[model samples]
Target: MAETDKFAVQPHADATSQQQAHSLEHWRSHTGRNDIITGLRAMHVWLALGWHDIRQRYRRSVLGPFWFTLTTLVMVGVLGFMYSELLGQEISDYLPYLGIGMVVWQFISTAANEGCNAMIGAGSTIKQIRMPLTTHVCRMVWRNLVILLHSLPVVVLLMVFFGHSLTLEFLLLVPGLLILMLNAVWSGIVFGILCARYRDVMPIIGNLFQVGFFLTPVMWRASDLKERAWIADINPFNHLIEIIRAPILGTPIMLEPWLWSLALIFLGFAAAHYLMVRFRERVAYWL
Candidate 1:
C-alpha cells in the first residue's frame, strides 16, 4: 500500500511542476506586451521627463537650445560651400540640399548614438522603480526630438536663402517624419537594451555610425555617384535621407524610398518587440 501511494504522488507532483512552468512562460509574454503598451500610454510621464532633460541641458544659458540652432547654421554654411566646391556642384543647388540633409542626419544620428545609453543611463531609476523599461527609451527619443525642433530654424533659413518656394508637395514631410520617428523609437529600444546588457556594444555602434556618416550622402549628392548611382541606391541611409531631403528641396519624391522606409519600420519594430519580450525582465537585473 505504501509503495503504490508513493508512485501516485510522484505523477501528481510532476503535473503541478509542468503547469507552473507554463504559467511562468505566459506571464513573461504578457508582461512584454504590457511593458510597451503601458510605456506608450504613460506619455505624460516620459514627456515631462524628456522636456526636463532639454531644459536642464541648457539651464541658465542666454540662448538655451537655440545655441544648437546656431551650430547647425554654421555647419551648413561652411560644409555646404566646401563640399559644393570639392564636388563641383552648383552652390545654389547644394546649400539647401546639404542644409536639410544635415538637419535630418543630425536627428537620426543623435537619436541612435544616445540610444545606446538610454537604459544604462537610467540604471538607477530602473533598479529603484517598477515602471516599464520602454519609458526610458521614449524619453531619450523625445529629448532629441526637442533638439530637432530647435534646429528647424536652420531649415527655414535655408529655404529662404536659397529662394526655394514651398509647394503642395512639402506635405510629403508629414509621412516622411512619421516613418523616421518610428524607426528611431525601435532602434533606441534595441540599442538601449543591448547596451545595458553588454557595455562594449555601445562603442561598436558609435563607430559604425561614424563610418556611416561619410558613406551616407549628407555633404554630397547621390547624383555625384553618376554611373555608380546604384551604390547610393543600395544604402538604407540614402533612402531614409532622400525621403525628407527631396521634399525640402522640391525634388520629385520617388516611390522606392517610401517602400524601403516602410519595410524598415516593420522589420525594425518586429525585432524590437521580440527583444522586449525575451529580455524585458532581464533588463533590470542587467542594469
Candidate 2:
C-alpha cells in the first residue's frame, strides 16, 4: 500500500513539473524578448516556406513562374482595353490604372482568402511541435508577396508603355506596401484563429472576397463611378488601393483614405491581438 501510494504521488509530482515548465516557456515566448527572437526566426522560416510554395505552384509547368506574370499581363491588357472602350476612356491612361488596381487587388484578395486557413493548414505541425502561431501567418504573407513581386514587372511595363512619368511620389508605394502587409498580418491572425474554430468560415470568407472583387474599383476608375463615388469612400479596400494608385499617378494621398486605413489598422490589430491572447492555448485542439 505504501509503495503504490508513493508511485502515484511521484507521477503527479512529475506531471506538475512538466506543466510548470510548459507554462514558463509559454510566458517566455509571449514576452517581448522572446517575441523579437521569434519574429526574426519566423521571418527566415517564412522566406523558405514562401519559396517552396512558389516553386510548388508552378512545378513541372513549361512556362513556370513566368506563367503568373504572363497571365496577369494578358488579363489586365484584355480587360483594360475592353473596359476603356466600353467606358469611352483613353486606353493609355486607363490601362495603367487597371494594371495597378488589379495588382493591388490580387494581394488583398489573396490575403483574405488564404489567411483564413493559415493555422488550420498547419495542423500537423502545430500538433507535432510547439511553434509560434504568428509564424504561419507570416508564411502566408510572404507567399502572397512572392506572387506580388512576380507581377511587378507588369507594373513597370505599363508605366513605360503608357509614357507615364515616374516621380518621387511613386515611392509612396513603399509605405503602401507596408500598409498592405500590416493588413495581411492582422487578417491572418483573426481569420486563421476563427476558421480554426469554425471551419465554415473558410467558405464564407471566400464568397465574400469574390463579391468584394467586383465591388472594388479594380478594373474601373473611381471617376467612372461618378454619382456613386461614396462606394469608394465606404470601402476600406478602395482606400488601400488608393494608397498605391494615387502616388503612382502623381496624385496626393487623400486625407480621408489615410485616416480610414489608419483606423482599420488599429482596429484590426487590436482585434487580432485580443483573439490571439484569449485563444492561443486552444488553437492546437481546435485545429
Candidate 3:
C-alpha cells in the first residue's frame, strides 16, 4: 500500500509542475502590440481630441495658434542678427541655418516636454475609461505636430529671404520627419509611465532638457567644434535634428546622422514596447 501511494503522488507532482510552466510561458508571451493596434483603430477619437486640444488652448485668443509663428519669427530675428555678429558668420547663411535648427528643436522640445505628461494629464480619463493609454500619448504628439506646421512659415520665410533653393534633397525630409515622429511616440510612452509612477522624474527631465539644449548643435555649427566634433557625433538628439535641418537647408545628409537615427528608432520602440508590457497595467493605480 505505501509503495502504491508513493507512485501515485509522483504523477500528481509532475502534472502540477507542467501546469505551472505553461502559465509562466503564457504570461511572458504578451508583446504589447495590442495597445498600438487598438489605438490605431480608435484614430477618430484621438485625432479629434488632438484637434480639440489645440482649439481649447487658443479659444480665447485672437491670434490663436499664429502665436507660435509670431514667437518663432521674433526669436529668429533677434537671435539671427545677434549670433551672426557674435560668431562673425555671414547673416545670410547663418540666419537660415539658425531658423531651421531652432524650429526643429522647438518641435522636438515641445513634443518631449508634453510627453512627460501624456498619461498624468489625462488622469481622469485613464481612471474612468477603458481606452488604450497609447491613445493619450498619440493625442499629445498630434497636437504638437500641428503647432510645428504652423511655425513652418517662419522657416520658409527665412529660406526665401536668405536665397536658399529647394532641391531634390527636400525629399529626405519626409523620412526624417517620420523617424522623428516615431521617436516622439515611443519617447512619450516611456516618459509618461515614468512620470506617472514617480512625479519627481518630471522635474529631472526638465533640467535635463535645459542641459540638452546647450549641448545640442543648434546654437553653434559642428565645424565650430572641429576636433571636438564627436560631441555632436555621439548625440542622438543632434542626429535627429540634423536629418530634418540638413534637408531643409538643402545640404547633404551625413552618413553618421542616418546611421544613429535608424539605430535609435529601433531601440526606442523596442524599449517602449517592453515597458508597456510590464507596467501598463499598473499605471492607473499609480496615478
Candidate 4:
C-alpha cells in the first residue's frame, strides 16, 4: 500500500509539470502572435499620423514646407565654406563631404531628439484612444524622414555644384539611407520607451548630443585626426556617414566601417525589440 501511494504521488507531480510546460508554451505563442498583429496594425496608423504631423508642422509658416529645404541649404553653404577653409581642402571636394555629413547628421539628430519624447508628445492621443504604443514612435520616425526628404534637394544642388562626376555608385545611397533609417527606428523605440519611464532621460540625451557634435567628424575630415583615427572607427555615426558619403563621392566604401555599422545596427534593433516586447503593456501606463 505504501509503494502504491508513492507511485500515485509521483505521477501526479509529473502531470502537473507537463501541464505547466504546456501552459507556458501556449502563453508564449499567443503573446508572439499578438505582438506581430499589433505591430502591423500600428504601422498603418503610423503612416496617417506621420502625414498629419507634416501638415501640422508647416500649416502656419509663411514659406511653409519649403522652409526645410531653404534652411538646410543656408546652413550647409555656411558650414561648407567655413569648414573648407579650416580643413585646408578645396571648396569643391570639401563641400560635398560637408554637405553629406551635415545632411546625415540632421536626420540622425532629429530622430534621436524627437524619439526621446515620441510617446510623451502623443500623450493626449494615447490617453484618449486605445492604440498600440509602437505607433507613436513609428510616427515620429516617419515624420522626421519626411523632413529629410524635403531637404534632399539641397543635397542634390550641392552635389551638382561641388561634386565630382556622378556615377552608378551613387545608387549605393539607397541601401545606406535604408540602414540609417532602420537605425533611427530602433533608436527611437528604445529611447521613446526609456524616456517615458524616466522623464530625466530627455535633458541628459540632449546634452550628450550637443557634446557629440564636436566629437563627430561632420565639419572635419577623418584624415585630420591621424593620431585619433580610432575615434571615427569607434563612433557609429562616423561609420554611418562614411557609408553614405563614400559612394556618393565615387569612392569605394571601406569594409571595416561598413561591417562595424551593420553590427551596431543589428545590436540596436535586437535590444529595442526585446525592450518593446518586455514592456509592451507597461508603456501605456508610463506615458
TM-score of each: 0.87, 0.85, 0.87, 0.83
lDDT of 3 at 84: 92
Clashing residue pairs in candidate 4 are none
Per-model C-alpha RMSD: 11.5, 9.7, 12.2, 11.6
- Supply candidate 2's per-residue lDDT for 156: 67
Error of 3 at 284 (Å): 0.5
lDDT of 3 at 91: 89
* Candidate 1 worst ten-residue window by lDDT: 23-32
lDDT by residue for model 4 (1-287), tens:
99999998998999999997985564344442254245435565689989998888888888766787787778888887887787788888877777778878888888999999988898887677656566677788788888887776567667787546777878888888888777887788788889999999999888988888888898887778999878876888888888888877888767876787789788987877788678866767887
Q: What pairs collide in candidate 1? A: none
Q: If the candidates were sorted by their TM-score against the true structure, best first, what order would they fall in?
A: 1, 3, 2, 4
Candidate 3 lDDT by residue in tens digits, 1-287: 99999999999999999997975554344335567555645568789999999999999999998999899889988998999999999988898888878888888888888999999999999898767787899899888888888887668677877787888888888898888877888889889989999999999888888899999988799889999989988888899889988888888768889888888878987888888888888998988
Between 3 and 4, whose lDDT is larger? Answer: 3
Candidate 2 TM-score to native: 0.85
lDDT: worst 10-residue window of model 4: 27-36
Ranking by lDDT: 1, 3, 2, 4
> Can you tell me which runs of candidate 2 are displaced by over 4 Å?
1-28, 31-41
Candidate 4 overall Cα lDDT vs. reference?
A: 0.78
